[model samples]
Target: MEENRLPFDAVILAGGRSSRLGGVPKQDLVFHHATLLQRALAASAGAAGTVVVGPRPEFSLPGVILCREEPEFAGPAAAISAGLEALARHCTSASEYTLVLACDMPLVQDAVAVLKEALVPAKGDGVMARSGDGTLQPLAGIYRTTGLKKAAEELASRGTLNNGSVRSLLASLEVQPVTVPAGSTADVDTWDDAAALGIAAGNQDKKPGPAQPQLTWEARS
Candidate 1:
């Protein structure tokens, strides 16, 4: 609740098929002392409201609006659309932005603060973290609710949301891409990736703190 920070809502996309991970839901995958979804919810606790778009899991957190995409397991874009709809139900005028996140990213919390802070100066539809290898981590960003709603509606109209690419949804928006340090955008798409992050095999002692300021975009060109 910093004076300079704009109020926002949060949408955690947790409805993935996890085809490569033996059909286990990634959100339920645990790391440290919490599940991936729990970590995401904790990181976004500062938001005015939070909507988790996926099946309601046995593990619950207070104040989280749990929902699922229509047709279930549609795709990321469809999940986003579902999340936006849930967000609309609870958002107030004070909510200016929506933080979009994927549940598989265990280390995403470190990127949240910086993305929200950068969104102000960005003056764009949203601000996403760019990996050190130059990949856009769209799910790990904050977006203007108006812009996101418009995009979601347009995608639904075109009947492409169910299987559409997120890049397509963002193509029309003016986005700020801020580069982040290595591992900040690392996600568990497979057991190998999870093990690498010290999550799959239970190595919680390796958890790192937020990326150093020197490794953030603010310190780079």
Candidate 2:
């Protein structure tokens, strides 16, 4: 943590209707002996407070705030709004930014740290992770708390938040993109994605004990 870098509070969005993976809750999926939600929480261990926005998580984590977007399964934008509301209670003058993450990204910690470091060199509303193909992974980024709150609120007020896209929520903010490694932006939406990430297939989804790390971000050229 640098003196100039804002203290981070985090919001993990876990409430999605996983229609692609036979309705399995992505947050409940295992990765390296931990649930996807747990891995996400571990990554935010440095934050002042962490909020998990979704239906009640299967596992309990002390000091974590669990919330859900209004109307349920209301997409990322509404989920973000729900997270912002939970965060408002815990944010202080020292907590200037929010680290937003999607629960399904299993290997996002390094990129999370890198995004934090990027904040030191680039001044913007936030530092977002960009995929190799140049798509913005908005959930894998740090945002100024005030700016995010405003954006979330504006979208909700406009009545477009239910199942709304994240891009709409962030349309007004000046976000700097830091290109992250491939799997850092990978999210599991289908069974193939899960299996590719070391998650067992079929009846073996719970083959548990602990799986190994499936990918790591390589150094930039």
lDDT of 1 by residue, 1-221 (tens): 35246888888998888998888888777777567877787678678877888877654356677778888888888888888887666555537788899988888878886786677678779898898888999989888888988998898898888888778788788989988767877999988998887775443332223421111111000
lDDT of 1: 0.77
Deviating ranges (above 4 Å) for candidate 2: 1-5, 90-94, 202-221
For each candidate, what is the lDDT? 0.77, 0.79
Encode model 2's per-residue lDDT on 137-218: one tens digit a residue. Answer: 9989888888988887787788888888988888999999998877787889999999889876444343323332332222
Candidate 1 residue pairs in backbone clash? none
